[model samples]
Target: MRPAVFFDRDGVLNEDDGYAFEPSKIRWIKGAPEAVRAVNQSGYLAFVVTNQSGIARGFYGEHQVHALHEWMAAQLADVGARIDEFAYCPHHPEGTVTEYRQTCSCRKPQPGMINELSKRHSVDIHRSIMIGDKQSDLEAASAAGVTGHMFRGPDLKEFVAPLLKQLPRIR
Candidate 1:
């Protein structure tokens, strides 16, 4: 099994403009692509895990979320980075859309997404790490048995460098 780096989509990969689904509203956070590239170059699988309550609230559809992710992946690819997978939760208990209103396990603060990724990718949870700007992100990481790094910084690469450096070199 190999180690992986899980990143939160909003606030970490892009500026969180409330319910940002439009392509025009997407703004990549400083050094976000470079950070993912570094992880790729280091041979670590990179993934994005996010909670898209907007889908449940009727702000956007699942297709729009996928389109945004595709755009993000293309942007990363342009910079020689790649995200192995994307896990998103479009469910919320209080959601306006009846179909999306049920509570689900894939949401953050739960390990559903991470666990599923681990199973699919054969990732070593103990060796993996998650980076995000929220406490819920850390809680999810902990529940998944992975180290969680809180990012509150000037740039994504700068904030992630030291943590990446601490990881033992994988053969």
Candidate 2:
């Protein structure tokens, strides 16, 4: 099984522009692309797991989120980096959209997304790591049996480079 790196999209990969669902609003965090490339070279699968409560809140639709992600992927491709897959939860308990108003397991601090991804990708949870800028992110990672790192930085590559060195390399 391959170990993976789970990234919290908003605060970790890009600036959280409050319900940002447009490519124009995306401002990637410093070294975000390089950090991802490092993971790619380290033989770790890179995945994005995020919560998009804005969908439930009616601020945007799933199409917008998907389009934004596609745009983001193309941006990363420009730097020779690629995210294997993207997973996001649109459910919110208190929401304007009736279809997505109920609480679901896929949300952050819930571990549902991580658990599902681990199962589907055949991930070695023990060696997997999660990096996020929130307590909830760590909580979710713990629940899923993966190590979690808190990031407070202006440069992602600086924070990630050393951490990548410690993980067991996969063929």
Work out the TM-score per prediction. 0.98, 0.98
lDDT of 2 by residue, 41-137 (tens): 9999999999999999999999998999999999999999999889999999998999999988899899999999999999999999999999989
| lDDT for each candidate structure | 0.92, 0.94
lDDT of model 2, residue 126: 95
In terms of lDDT, model 1 sits at: 0.92
User: Across residues 1-171, which tens digit of lDDT does each residue of candidate 1 receive?
Assistant: 999999998999999888988888898889999999999988899999999999999999999999988888888999999999988999999999999998788988998999999999999888899998999999999999999999885699988788889987778
**Model 2 off-target regions past 4 Å?**
none
Off by over 4 Å in 1: none
Candidate 1, position 32, lDDT = 94
